[model samples]
Target chain A: MNEQPVIRTQGLTRYFGAKPAVYDLNLEVPRGCVFAFLGRNGSGKTTTIRMLLGLLQPTRGEGSILGHDIRSLPPEARARIGYLTEEHQLYDWMRVKECGGFQSQFYPRWNEKIFRGVIGHFNLKPTARVKDLSRGERAGLCLGLTLAPEPELLVLDDPAMGLDPVAHRSLMESMVYLTRRSDRTIFFSSHQLADVERVADYIAILDRSVLRMCCSLETFRNSVQQVRLRFPGPPPPLPDIPGLLQAFRAEGELRLTCVHYGATTEKALRALAPAQMEMVPLSLEDAFISYLGERGEKSFILSETEAQP
Target chain B: MSFNITISTGLNMPIYKQITDQVWLAFVTGKLAVGDQLPTVRTLAEDLVVNPNTVARAYADLMRDGLIESRAGRGVFITRKRKVFTREEGWRRLEPLIDAAIGEAMTMDFTHQELREAFEKKLGQWKHVKGGN
Candidate 1:
């Protein structure tokens, strides 16, 4: 694998008027990993992606995509990237074949076979009007078109949003098919953690427009955990423990979430003399919420009764 | 030949871990007999809709642990290793979980005697469950 990062940013800052959308952010998306850009709603994920693609200007600092400066990206440089917007915005009147033909004109490396293969894999008809196709079929058509261009990098912005479960699976299967090439890099922003967990090898999570976490999915899952501790009686106040991401206490039962969790953290919790201490695994969603909770103001831990929902 | 392995890919447990655990369990229980060719990494990844590398990692780990081995140009297969080794590997992988569960039981105020008896009963109930597989 090439050592060069396909996307690199330093001190990347973007503000919407007086409010900061992304603060001095430094990010590196190396070549060939399915990188998931995650964040809560309005967390500047879209803002950073826009800046990277030169669609939005950053207030301060610099970014580079595919070794070209993001701000002054040459028109021709855009050809090397393909983007799938959340909404499939192809002309509704155009037939599937027309949509593919229109897009093929823009790319020098367009491959009809690859396009047809992906289209056929989705079982799409050449003459089907875009307007008449279901949302999933339209998305599949867009994907086939994107693959035809054979871009080195693919940026998808919540492409699965509003998709039904079967549609969601179809989209994911298409993405898996794409990864077989091994040289393609995918960067996308999404809130669907379950799907993210499946396909993303690397991830960067933004919380309140701040870069809260970045690492491989395996490393991320391994580092954070929920440890349920039991004391004979109501546990004492949690007392600002280091490495504690979030804490929930209700009578005799307590759950402590930890980040960069290791033996040292476990030992500290053990010293509190819990009758039993069991380390539990956190799903990607669980870890995401717990990490947000670590920010103090937005915690995932709730009172036993408030947690029913 | 088609192979089917079921895993709820991304709920709490890492998918790769789940993959390894399931494969290991199958091997120990003899459901995946010696010389059984496992699905190629790509096939399994496509089947599960997971990062191919994750499946490859699970297979790689099993190879490292001597549970499975891959032949060049021929797909991976379960090794004709001793069932005792798989049983030992089982303990290594599951001991922590067992310990934690028992710990949790104790903290919940179950007596040690009660915990021991419960584990015995549970083990008796589970011992032959996989024997059918």
Candidate 2:
């Protein structure tokens, strides 16, 4: 088995003239793993993907995809990796079959059977004009073309964007199916936490032009929590609790979001003598929101819970 | 149906642990018996829409715990050798949980006697419903 990472970057930075779009990004995507890249709007996800694909050059640092330098990714190197953009860009003029034919010519190893199989799998008409297809169908068609090339590395920039729930689920199912192939590596960025939860083994969350968290999905979930602590009166200013991501104060209650909540954190809270304390596990989206949100008046409303001594 | 295994997409529990817990529960509840075959990792992953590696890890852990075994060229089969838990052991496991419940009830204006009577009544109902199964 090849041990080299499919994607790697070292201090990858990009600036759009005066504004820094991506800053000091160092990422490593292992071979054959489904990796999800998550960030809010304009968080440099697209800039990073564009840089990795060699379409946009970084102002500093360097990266590589499939052993080819990102600064100088060869056309052949680019061909080995499939890419699906947020829009699922395709020619509106070509018929479905003609679209497949046009894509096949560019890839020397393109399998016509697989192309036809994917088209048939999605139940897309071979003769329908791209302009006539619904937005979801166009996304499916784009996915089909991306996969038909049999690329070893597949990079998707928010494939679930603009797709309905069913369409999103179908797209994710296709991604899950593709990961069965031993040599295929999929890196997708999306706002759909539910879809990401379904398919991603590893995840990277970006914030403010910098990579925030990158680890296995299990690790990310295991390490964060939403804790509720009730006091006699107003809660005091929280002590410097380790892994305290954010804390919100309300009437007689302090709601805390902590990363890596464990024995030590528990001990610290016990010292405070709260009437009651409960560590609740957050859903993936809740965790993501808490991680991104600041420590001001929290939007996480405290659910009513009376406390006993 | 072999095992109605479902993974909750919550941070409360890891997916692998959920898979392991669901399988173990199925066995202890007699829903899964000895020699029952489990689905392939790929199938379960697809069904749950999770990573195959996560499913594989769960299966591997179950094998390590000796609750399941893999037969070459066949598939994973339940081993059914886990130790039997007495009622006391089971209740011991739930002691802290009941404490937490009572704690909350106290906060909600229920007296200790009232809460105890309610719990005992519920236990009686469970005994009648379960029929010593």
Candidate 3:
């Protein structure tokens, strides 16, 4: 395994007019880890990715991708990265095989077998024109092109955007195949939390221009927990619990979402003297929603009365 | 052997832990036997559509627990040897399982006494089944 990070940035800031899109971002992506960049819409994920790939200029600070400066990444270094953006850009008039043929001309390391295998996996015909393919088929074509070269680092922006369930699974298998060698690193951003939960080893979340959380997938899942406390009556006022992401009441139970839930947090929770309490496990999506949800908002009414109609 | 492993993300456990538990269950239920070959980390990850490292961690845990062993070039295989744990280690491992069960029971409004009686009744049935076998 390589000792150096595949991608590193220091004070990477990008501004649009007067407003900041990404601010003072310092990130280090270790070698061979499947890093997922996550955020709500317009939260600087694409901006950060564009800056890393040198597609967009930054307002200030510096960064490097694959050991080359992002601002002046040479053709040779750029060729070693397989970039698949949301737009699956390909010539509309070209046939599938023609697309591969044209792309293969630029990279000396392009593998014909990899191209054919991925195409077959996606059930794409060699004669299919780029304009005739569906959105998912086009995505498959782009993935085949990007993967044929066997790039050292793959940067994907929302790879699962328009993919169906089966196509998404194929994409995941493609990723797993890439990392089989233990040296291929993938940096992708997606709104598909389920897929991200499955494939990502590390994750960096951009919360509205701020780098909110960056850690391993397990660490992220474990850190943000939901605790449900049931009282004999309506729930009491919640204590000033640190790291409290959200607090809500529903059906006489007070539920709290907290980050880095530990002993002191448990003690404070216990002091409320609730009739019952238990930590509710959250899936990655649930935790992500809670982590980003409004703080201190309460009330989720199941029904006005217990009597059934 | 026809191997089928399913992973559920909705569980209270992590993916790696779920894998280990399923393997453990398979071993105890005789679905997996000693010397039976297990899928390689890469194959299983691709099959499950999960990170290979997650499967690798589960395999590492199974090996640590003495339920499986990896042959240098061949692949991972189930082993007959089960680990002998010290008392403290045994308690450490069992504590979480006990805690979860009790927590569930408590949430369902069961008292400690009721849980104890239920456990005792279940144990008696298990003993009688073993005796009949």
RMSD of each: 5.6, 5.8, 7.0
Candidate 3's C-alpha runs over 4 A off are A229-236, A250-254, A273-277, A296-309, B80-84, B92-96, B106-117, B124-133
Chain B TM-score (each prediction, in order) = 0.73, 0.63, 0.77
Model 2 residue A160 distance off true place after TM-score fit, in angstroms: 0.8
True contacts kept of 1: 0.80
Q: In model 1, how large is the Cα lDDT of residue A218? A: 72
lDDT tens digits, residues B18-106, model 3?
89988877776667888999999988988888999999999998898888999999999999665457779989978867877887787
Worst 10 residues of 1 chain A by lDDT: A300-309
Segments in model 1 whose C-alpha atoms lie over 4 Å from true places = A294-309, B1-3, B80-95, B104-133
**Candidates 1 and 3, the one with greater lDDT:** 3
- Tens digits of lDDT, candidate 1, A1-309: 547888998889998889999998878897988999988889998889889999998999999998899999997779989888767789999999999899988888899998888777777899999989988788788888877888889998878877777767888888887898898899988888888888998888787877766678777777668888777788977766656778888778799887667767867887788877777777778887777774544333222122222
Q: Mark the regions of model 2 whose C-alpha exceeds 4 Å error after superposition.
A: A230-237, A250-253, A296-309, B6-14, B61-66, B84-98, B110-133
- Report clash pairs, candidate 2: none
**lDDT tens digits by residue: candidate 1, B16-91:** 8889988877776557777889989999999899889989989888888787989999999988554435667777
lDDT of 2 at A188: 95
Q: Model 3 over residues A276-304: C-alpha lDDT tens digits?
A: 77788887777877776676222111111
